[model samples]
Target chain A: MAQIRMETNLLGANDMLAAKNRRIFKARGLLVINLMSSPGSGKTTLLEKTIEALRGRIELGVIEGDLYTDQDAMRIENKGVEVVQINTEGTCHLDAGMIEKAWSRLEHLPIQLLFIENVGNLVCPAEFDLGEDIRVVVLSTTEGHDKVLKYPLVFQQAQVVVLNKIDLLPYTDFDLNAFNRDLQLVNPQIRVFQLSGRTGEGLAQWTEWLVEEVGKRVI
Target chain B: MHEMSLIAEMMNMVRESAAHNNITRISRIKLVVGKLTMAMPHSLRFAFHTMARDGLFQGTELLIEEREVAYQCCQCGEKYLPDMPYGQLCPNCGSKASHLLSGRELFVEYYEGDSGKGEENGANTHGN
Candidate 1:
């Protein structure tokens, strides 16, 4: 081809489509939060707990992004909320275009707060914003304190940081103090919640926070 | 990893630009990537060769230039590259930095190849 001078971003299309998705959610007054983390970071477990606690408090829907299985979507569906599953096959991350397609599928459904559980990857998922009002990342205590420093982008972009699996802290060498210190160095404005999904500890805090966030969207 | 998807998207954009500029074929492609992305160059090259061999321009030489990690220290108003990747503390005054000045870029700077003479498929000019 002719040597042409072109300056185009790799994620330009995804970003534009994400803006459109955000507009649609905003127009419909739906507060959207994107949940991100590495595989097996207790994201779905936290979602299950949140759905159980806030089931009657707010209308909800979940868009689950998985590599091959619809298991996470099934979990949300069983909790009595609208759920949509997006199987990325082998894609490491979820982009805005995929979110737009999933949103279109749930347009007729009654959803006040949308939780988009992004593909389980700390690196790529954080690079692309899926029109989320807030981006929260879940880090389990088993993943250790070095993870925040290792994967700084995802932690830094997080509006809320959920440190899950705190019940197993006695078994692991995860230093919570160092985690908080590094988290502050990375993002001082981040809202941190240390919770255990299995034992039901600190679930009310997230549930209350979710209710308030959804309420803010209405006004 | 996802470099294949990235390459596919990038080539589509290149094809569109090629069509608009009346380029007959591309030989060399130059890209500027940021170190912060942590994308392996070998994987990127493998992705490019696997997909580009049959589509658009075949046997195109890919050149990648990695940008250094650079950022501005929000607290001390000093700018410097940290010793470690994904470092949050500023070495200057030990303050948390904000603005990222470079090293997150993923874009094609330009390409070099022969273009179809505007008067049809006739002449070839030295493209740099």
Candidate 2:
């Protein structure tokens, strides 16, 4: 029997493409954000609010990843932003390769802030890095506070968390203290913005932070 | 599950290596998976079996080495192992500035296979 030593990463190909994407974004001075969440976490609504708040101020573009339909992409496009849709068919996550293919179509557009709305999956999407400047996870109050502990990887890797559906916080049993404590344990440095997409409450803070990020990335 | 895709990538790597070294009928494959990867070993094993049904990977045994989440406290400069991904706070100094050192490993370490010229009955034909 012959033993062949091949110590290599399983996601080496994906990581390499991610590095390439990072380089491209850096050269273009584009602030890329990978938005992740569960299916019903109000990610699309958050994007729509962000677009309304930052439109004409920052050149914004979006790449929407969905399982089959381009519903989210149409929503973003209706907000007057150039949106590209990538239907992964049945894949749960958007890898670097998919992002690369999507970005090629949007590279010519005047985009300074690019948001890649990843497939609404907390697990698989966290494993594949799409070479974004920031990783944001949107968690709704309806999703429960235990999500941080149940899916620690997604929270641990995220730089920011948008606590969406805050207007419904009074209606649900989502404990804010427990959520903050769990998130603190998982990611101590994570910045969180509590906002409701339906009512547009507490959205200025989120959009302001995004504008600041885009400003910092601009040359 | 995404484990199927992970196994498919592993098979691609194994096939390339086998072609390069002229290995046939791979018998053993070793993998290192970290706890922070969130990839369950049982699921990975099931994926391997389902994907390796035929071809050069048929009848292969998979060996997995699971690694715990390791972190280093940035403030106190102390190394520690967290029981869970959320338990990353430094125990010695109660600091939250913990940097993950080695917990996200997911890789194929090595594999053992038989060359067509080697002994068929597990006899040591090549020098160890």
Of the candidates shown, which would achieve the greatest DockQ relative to the real structure? 2
Q: List the residue pairs that clash in candidate 1.
A: A1-B23, A1-B25, A1-B26, A2-B23
Q: What C-alpha lDDT, on a 0 to 100 scale, does residue B52 get in candidate 2?
A: 89
**Residues A88-109 of candidate 1: C-alpha lDDT, one tens digit per residue:** 9998988898999999889998
Alpha carbon deviation, residue A48, candidate 2 (Å): 1.2
* The 10-residue segment with the lowest total lDDT in model 2 chain B: B119-128
In the range A132-177, model 2's lDDT, one tens digit per residue, is: 9999999999999999999999998999999999999999999999
In candidate 2, the residue pairs with backbone N, CA or C atoms under 3 Å apart (3 or more residues apart, or in different chains) clash, namely: none
- Kindly report the fnat of each predicted structure, to 2 decimals: 0.43, 0.59
| Model 1, global lDDT | 0.83
Model 1 residue B39 distance off true place after TM-score fit, in angstroms: 2.0
Model 1 C-alpha lDDT per residue in residues B82-111, reported as the tens digit of each score: 775567678888888568898889888787
Question: Model 2 misses residue A34 by how many Å?
Answer: 0.2
Tens-place lDDT digits, model 2, residues B1-128: 66777888899988888777777789999999988888889999998988787658888999999988888999989999975545778889988888888778999888888776775434332221
